[model samples]
Target: MELIRYAFVGVLNTGLGYAVIFLCMGVLDWSPVASNIAGYAVGFVVSFTLNRSFTFRSKGPARRELRRFLLIFALAYLANLAVLVLCVHAMGLDGGWAQVIAGFGYFGLSFALSKYYVFAEGAGHRDAGSTGHV
Candidate 1:
């Protein structure tokens, strides 16, 4: 159920990410890294809200969750940036195309982090029988 919700959110986030990346790299001619960063910033707000409310149904305080979320996304950014670099330099893909490929791997990482580290079963988030309502 959580995975299903995450996938739904991922689709929306992916759309925003691709649009930002396209506008940055294809239109504004920004570097791949810059474009990726911009896309991530835009997607982060949406992802955080959905994951907190609908996905994990987190009851945690916003600050703690926000901090953990930032950390997870920081790792995601670095990992996806590496993927983008590899695709562009080694695989001979353009920046825009590389971003498309990187999105797949990044989504997996983000989902794992959300499920375990960020919105885990205890302390901050809701568990089995708890109302989990703040």
Candidate 2:
């Protein structure tokens, strides 16, 4: 159930992020890299809010959770980049395909980090698992 909610939020985040990226690139004339950065910046806030409230149902200190979430995102992003680079440069894969593979890596890593580190069962003011609403 928790995983389902998390996946739902992820889908929302991905849609919004892609929209932002496309808008930036098409309308604002931003470079692809810049658009991607902008997309991720927006996604970060959306992901954190939804994951905390809807997915994990965390009653944690917002400040603490925000900080940990940021750390987890950074780590996951770095890992994703590493995989992308390895796939594209080392393995001679197509850039588009490499990005798809890297995205999967990022999703799995971010979900685990968010679940265990950012919104762990006992890390919150109330136990995350104690939320009766699921």
Candidate 3:
């Protein structure tokens, strides 16, 4: 159930991101790289809010959570950019199509990293399962 909600949020974010990229590059005649940067910036804010409040429901320190979130997203952004460059420039694909492919390509890895690293709690513990000791 939670995973479904998380996936829904991701889909929304992805749509928002792709729309911005497509509009900036397609309608406005911007470079793919420039449009991609703008699209990523906007999507980062949306992803942060949805993931923090809904997906992971993080209750950790705000500053730390934000920092970690940015860090993880930085990596994801790089991966996304690499995919875009390869698919668009190297393969001579359409910019919008390239971004579409990259978006799907990076989704799973981004989710896993953000779940386990960005919004995680309790000093890096992953043993979310309980021992029923109390």
Candidate 4:
């Protein structure tokens, strides 16, 4: 199923994201939020590549796709930050645990925005079959 493939791709990206955050915070002494943001940036790069070439199998212009991906990531970044802060600051969760808690929401939001808008063919195309490729 396409959803299964999406999950697989997500797993890889999550690993990439976690690795970057772990290195930045655990090794370089960055703040948890700052480290998480850095990891998001790195993971975005990987996700854009993998989502286009492998996940969605997009057949579109690279420049346009990248621009759209960046736009979606900007929104996703805000969403991720909101979830993180809500979990950590409002809910009184540990920083690390908050990130884990936010990951599910991030995954759902990013996948929806990306599959429907960011990486879809042309502008705002919602061809589920075309966009949901492994």
Candidate 5:
């Protein structure tokens, strides 16, 4: 049940992110990289909120969760970048294709980190196997 909610929220986050990117690129004429960065920023907030309220049902302080979320996401971002660089340069993959592969890895890693670290069921914040807000 929790996993299902998480995936559902993830899909929503992806859609919202793409929408932001499209708007930025098409309407504002932003660069693809810039648009993507904007998209991910918005998506991060949405993901955190949905995952906390709907998926984990957490009951913790917003400040603590927010700080932990920032740390986890920062690491995730670096890891994704590393994967992308490795795939494109070392494996000779196309940049777009490399990003696709890296995105999958990021998704898995993000899920695990969200569950165990950012949204853990304890440590001064948690709710009976559940988690809370963005």
Candidate 6:
């Protein structure tokens, strides 16, 4: 299913992003903020590419989809941060646990936005049938 593919891409993106973040912080002596930015930059590109080609099988123009994807990603990320802050500061939850909760919010919003707005069928070009190919 499309949801399954999206989840698979999310997992891959998360793993790769964390690896980049840790590498930048530990090996390149980058600040946590800088490392996080670098990691997310990589994730942005990978998420778009995989979600477009693999998950949605969209034949839409890359530029158009990318612009919409950027917008959705920003909105979802802001929501994620808000959830994290609320959980940690208001609810007095541990930072790690709050991050986990925030991540679910991020994932749900991202998937919904991507499916309905960014790569919806007939948004630009028609999507391919479910061939399960990348």
Global lDDT of each candidate: 0.85, 0.89, 0.79, 0.79, 0.82, 0.90
- What residue pairs clash in candidate 1, if any at all? none
Query: Worst ten-residue run, lDDT, model 4?
Result: 124-133
For candidate 6, write residues 1-134 as lDDT tens digits.
Answer: 78898999999999999999999999999999999999999988999999998888787778999999999999999999999999999999999999999999999999999989998853323534643343
List, residue by residue over 66-128, the lDDT tens digit for candidate 5: 788888888887889999999999999999999999988887787788788877853323444
Candidate number of the best lDDT? 6
**Which lDDT tens digits does candidate 2 get at residues 46-111?**
999999988887877888999999999899999999999999999999999999999999989999
Candidate with better lDDT, 1 vs 3: 1
In terms of TM-score, which candidate is strongest? Answer: 6
lDDT of 5: 0.82
TM-score of structure candidate 5: 0.75
Candidate 3 colliding pairs, count: 0
Q: What TM-score number comes out for model 4?
A: 0.65
**Cα miss at 114, model 1 (Å)?**
0.9
Residue 19 accuracy (lDDT) in model 6: 97
Report the error of model 2 at residue 126, Å.
7.7
Candidate 6 overall Cα lDDT vs. reference?
Answer: 0.90
Q: By TM-score, how accurate is candidate 6?
A: 0.80
Residue 70, candidate 4: Cα error in Å is 1.2
Clashes of each: 0, 0, 0, 0, 4, 0
Clashing pairs in 4: none
Off-target runs (Cα >4 Å) in candidate 2 are: 23-38, 121-134
